[model samples]
Every structure is written in C-alpha cells, then in structure tokens.
Target: MKRIIPLLIFCFLLAGSGCANKAQSGAGIGALAGATIGALTFKNKASGAAIGAGIGALMGYIVGNEWDKYDEKQVSQTLEANQSGQTSSWTNPDTGKSYSAVPSPAYMKQGQVCRDVTITEDGGEQILAKACRDEDGVWRLQQ
Candidate 1:
C-alpha cells in the first residue's frame, strides 16, 4: 500500500507533462507496473523494483517505438487515401496486440495538413492524438 502511493504520485506527475511522447509514457507506465510486480514478488522490494524498472523500460521503449512506427504508417496512409471516418486496424504478430485508428477529417493549420486520430488498443485503452504533415511530406505526431 505504501509502495502504491509513491507509484500513484509518480504517475500523476508524469501526467502533468503536457507534451509526453510515446517512449516517455511507455517508460513511466512500465516502471510503475514493474515496481508493483517486483514489490509483490521479491523479498527486497527496492532491488526488485530497480531490476524490474530497467527491464520494463527497455521492453517499453521497443514496444512503444514499434507502435509509433505503426501509427505513423497508418496515419499517413489514411491521409493519403483521404479516408476520413474510416477505421483501420492492425495486429502485431510478435505480441498479438491489436490496435485501431480512426482519423477525423484532415484540415489545414498554418498551411500544414493536420488530422486528429483516436487510437484504441486491444485492452480498450484509447488516446486522441494529433498528427501533422512536415515540410518533407512526412506525417509526424504533434508535440
């Protein structure tokens, strides 16, 4: 219970960051999960949490990186295809995690094309994200 309090506080602090990227979010969530599991499983909570956090961060980074790529691709394709209100889904074969994205209509912002997308994960987590086209014609998440 004491450990959980600190983790909750950490998460609240993390949430206060306005422009958190995927890796940061992943690391924070992963660390929290790792610490909880470690505290419950090991006699030495501190050591377990340290080891678990490291492993969790690594795994989270890899997974989050892949998800970022996948999102970019999906968003780009949706924009190019001009298919607003369409739902596209994909499943990672390695992890068996499924994801879906529904893009809103594309609009112009400061002469740049932008879109809002609602992404849903297999476990029902959802995030609303904004993506914009760069000068190089590549779509990137808006900070």
Candidate 2:
C-alpha cells in the first residue's frame, strides 16, 4: 500500500506537469522519477527526493543551456550565410573545433532556413544543430 501510494502520486504529478511544453515540466517529471528510483535504492524518501531534484535540476539546466547557445549561434550563422551567400562554418577558434554548414535546399528555396545543420568539431564530435526560419524568412533559434 505504501509503495502503491508513491507510485500513484508520481503518476499524477507527471501527468499534471506534462500538460505544457515548458522545460519546468521536464524537470518536474525528472524529479519524480529520480525520487522514486532513489527511494527504492536507498529506502529513504527525503534523501531520494532531494537527490532526485538536484539531479533533475542539474540535468535540465545543462541540457537547456547548451541548447540555448547552439540555437542562437546556429540562427545567426544561417542568416549571415544567407546574406553573404556563404555557407555557415564554425570553429571554436581557440580549440580548433571546426564544422561546416549543410543547408537544406527545401528550406533554402522557401527562405534559406537551416533547420538541420551538421557539426563536426576537432574532437570528432558530430552533432546536429536544429534551427528554424523566422517570420521574416530569416533563420532563427527556436527560443
């Protein structure tokens, strides 16, 4: 009965927060899952909740922060590319982290919107930078 109560509460909280697309919802659900799992592992609900919330918050912030920076830079690069007739190429400049932009022709035909870009840094890290075209037909970050 005690275990079932916690499970039910967790479900209720997750569903309630999932109603919106806000990042807080992600953190909320993360905390719930973290707490539940932590409790099962350590048999301490308070410790679990605290640990879970801390983990969730940190993960959320990290993922969110990286995304925000990438999105902004991607947008700026896309528009600058469009204006200069040059494709986007980025590098850490300090770390020799370098990558080139591959624009989607479909989006470019519409307005040079670089929705998905391929990034290859010197560390051999290949990443996808997702971007979108703004109301002015200029590429921009989703934020």
> What local distance difference test score does each model get?
0.72, 0.54
Count of backbone collisions within predicted model 2 = 0
Candidate 1: tens digits of C-alpha lDDT, residues 1-143: 55556764574456345455566667677766776677678798777776676676667667767766765686677666657888888776655778888889889999999999887879597888888889998888776
TM-score of each: 0.59, 0.40
User: Against the true structure, whose TM-score is highest?
Assistant: 1
Kindly report which residue stretches of model 1 are placed more than 4 angstroms away from their true locations once superposed: 1-22, 29-63
Clashing pairs in 1: none
TM match of model 1 to true structure: 0.59
Candidate 2, residue 136: how far the Cα is off, in Å: 5.5
